[model samples]
Target: MARIPTAELSRYLFAGQIGHRGCLRASRIRIAPTSSSLQTRQFASHVESQAPTATTVPPTPLRKQLKEQAKALKASGQKKKKKVDNQTVPGWELTVGIEIHAQLNTARKLFSPAANSFNDDPNSHVALFDVAMPGSQPVFQPETLIPAVRAALALNCEIQRVSRFDRKHYFHWDQPSGYQITQYYEPFAKDGKLELLARDGIAAEDGESITVGIKQVQMEQDTAKTTAQPGEVQWLDFNRVGVPLIEIITLPEIHHPATAAAFVRKVQVMLNAVDACVSGMEAGGLRADVNVSVRRTDDKCGTLGTRTEIKNLSSFKAVEDAIIAERDRQIAVLESGGVVEGETRGWAIGSTETRRLRGKEGEVDYRYMPDPDLGPVVIDLPLVQYLASSSGLAPDAETDQLIEDYGLTAKDAISLMALDDGARVQYFYNVLDALEQKLGSASVDTIAVDRGLSTLAANWCLHELGKLTELSNNLGMTHKGECKVPSADLAALLYHLHRKEITAKVAKELLWAIFRGEISQGGVTEAIEANDLWFHELSEKEYSDLADQVVEGEDKVLGEFLRFAEGKGKAYPQGKLMFLVGKVMRAGPEQRMDPASVERVVRARIDEVYIPGLKSKE
Candidate 1:
């Protein structure tokens, strides 16, 4: 070891403190000065020193200050600008378009026979063609195309007679091939419209309907999925590669963020109804890319402003929120005299701002060319016609049919269709089917179907079973075969209630008991008998006697009723009258007593006894 000079050692220590990266600057470092140092305090300073004084103006009186503040507030109130609608920005127009990639529910991939799945072991479902192996040719499967056509029909799109595929040239780690196969130049379907009404769960603030135009729906192959940490080794799953995907493009007609969300929801319902897609968004079955632009709302605004793309919004809420955040960002930029640059942006989870991902890619950047391997997809007129008529009903049509045929209200019908992704609606129909089978006919003569059985089923399915699903951690009721109670049991319970064999209250009690496993027997009738829940009709005279006893015992309520009836009281004793009815029902066999009959008897007794007494007093 060598002894270093004092100044050289000091310099080395300083350099070590502020590393070569210059993370810490010398000016930021602080050092205490000693008497021997250049920056030192004066020696022998006195304990007491005279302080310099400055002149000050008098403070304003509190009252006068308050008066000035009040005047300022009044002036501000008078000059306050008009408030804009919160649903939309003032002096600016927002336009949005959505590009959704929905996976087709087919057994095989779009170009190979590998099973189309997402949950299988990584790379287990990949085919040789998926990996782009040497001499492996792409075999187009018709199974994938059928569902695409079905979805197009459900969305009211005109099927193209001849659609061709093109290769989108791009190099990525996940994409083994040098290009992606998509229907870029000629899509399969075009010019469709989706009607969104107030009852469709997505409506304007004024409850007006919006018709969103569909630009095109094209069939394409999905790229392989990649999952990795930042600056780490990437894990690639080729199972998603060559999977069937239908790219649904909408015209930039949407103006509101919430409306954009509603559009995605409506499309999900339609796809599910047609069995074209079964996996929900949580499972990566569908994803949306939002394109948004904001322009000044003035006469000078003729052309649209620059648009930016927000990619891979997985949830509906994310879609709406991302649009709002990006719209506001663009508006702020334009208001600040800054040009809105077109770029690809990404929304961080739980953030209210969009971050730039990259500059927007131009079509020329893709270098798209006609796919040399795959031929043109030609659709026959007969097949299209058959699918148009034979496919499952669209969500709107299904809702309408439910409202009409089953005599259900618009609210209840839409709710049934919306619950658990339409699984509860199927449960409702299953109950109806079970009831019809038990009653032996679908005619009005059947006691079950005659008395709005479908409406009854809908009510129970939503209120009762929906609550059960919520209490059970939402594990049941959304998916078929996961309901807390079987549909057959529900049908049986509804039968008893409708036939007057059991009261509604008893029906609810028995339903919970069944769900909680408190019932010893499996059948609803057996459980009702075991729980002593059967309904019994009371005669008119028996009801009158019970009411007379109740009225005689409730003298306080009787006096109140009399005073009110004779105009000597302030408010009517209607609630007290119902209280009396409750006492009468309790005085008798409450479970067996009909509440409506008891009420009628109680009201009659009150009128018969109190009204006459009041008349005599008058």
Candidate 2:
């Protein structure tokens, strides 16, 4: 809670009724109706009243004088503090828009023959044309357009039949040429929408929807990397200079920071679905610049305050924290009788506040002009429709279908979809299919194949076998073909676990044996027999006698139970009964007593033997 020093406040000078310090006049400062938390003070009015007359003289500069007055005015009124994590910022409205640069999934650069890989040796992948010599011209890569269409279709963007490229000029160490090539006037896609399926960690209730908007998805070239050490001079690596990127621009439809984070996650998931991009924000494959602006709670969009753009957020956590920080920061500035200015800012991953990268008077013109060399690219309709059809096999569509076809809960279906690689995801569904087929022939109730086996398959894949198996992605291998565990063995293992023929723990042991190739595929019965992993379930008559023996033999539990039945002691009798049942369970490891049955039989024996004996004695 450090106060802004009087001297430090001088840098916030802006135009209007306020023109630095000497320009303060008799104009009134009006803020909108305040919430109870901010307790908005009429500090500007107070300062106006305390202004010097025309005849009066002061030695200090106008900027310094205004800063001192502004500092003193903010301290006069105190307000109630609101929780940082609170859902609503009562007096203010937040608007956020994200711009993402997703690296395209291609072998070479967008306009050059350079290889597009992040891990290559510095400048090793750069072509001579990437350095942009005087006579060089740009050539378009046809293969890169496929993933771009996939992204646009997944986001529900309207595909523009013809889009042209423009030259964007900027002076930076990262740019090889004097300017970069991008889609400025005519982007290939526009007018897309994404309706979020969740709200604040909860599934969207029936008939509740929040849709963030996409303004455009433009293909552009990435810049180079500038490597700088603490004391050494900076060095530029042109390896990534002309790498292709799909820039997805969104309208300012986001209010909550969590909503913003979830939106980014959804985009990343979709990008992965099409193999469009690696989309690893941490590794710079995908990154975002977030624009945040605030207005009064009742204010209309036209009157919204100036925005601050936080640039190059590397991860989703960074995106969330940066938005929250900028939101509260703007509120504090406005509450302190200062105007929020539009500026470019940088946010490090773990930083508490954003740092000003550069100041902005308004928008900086990139001087965009159509590229003379490259032609206006026309998107083929059939190609786009094919991508849309191919995306049906993606996780989003597949997850919903799994829920409908198998009657699995939405949570279970999503868990199955979160399994990363395509092969692993396919393996899960295939095993579920195999188990359903096996159960349909062997069981009386065919419905168990759909409901019971689906749940069992998802559970074992996520919990028991999933935790033990390693995916190709985890090993940093890009190939997504085959996984370690065979689907047949997994199906058989879940079958035994579902039937209570083996404990879940025992099932895990058997799965690992098959994973190590110690047991062959479709060898669940052989593995159980060889390893004594088979478990037994007690019949009703046998469990009844066992429960009777447990009550008779455990005298300590009986004393505790009898006193509790008479209401003479303050202990729970069920705990003692469960403890006695656990002892019987340990004695017969071969027979894995269903815990629900043990508890039921134990309670019945207690009611029949202990309570009735007391009544007979009385």
Find the candidate with the highest TM-score and give its number: 1
Q: Which stretches of candidate 1 lie over 4 Å from their true place?
A: 1-85, 171-174, 205-207, 225-236, 348-351, 439-452, 473-484, 500-522, 530-618
Tens-digit per-residue lDDT, 470-519, candidate 2: 43124121334234566767877887777888887787777767666788
Model 2 gets an lDDT of 0.70
Candidate 1, residue 305: lDDT = 88
| Clash count for each candidate, listed in order shown | 0, 3
Q: Who wins the lDDT comparison?
A: 1
User: Which sections of candidate 2 miss by over 4 Å?
Assistant: 1-85, 118-124, 199-207, 225-239, 279-284, 360-365, 393-397, 419-424, 434-449, 465-482, 510-529, 536-618
Q: After superposition, how far is residue 23 of candidate 1 from its true place, in Å?
A: 24
Minimum summed lDDT over a 10-residue window in model 1 is located at: 39-48
- The TM-scores, one per candidate, come to 0.73, 0.71
Q: How far out, in Å, is residue 552 in model 1?
A: 9.1
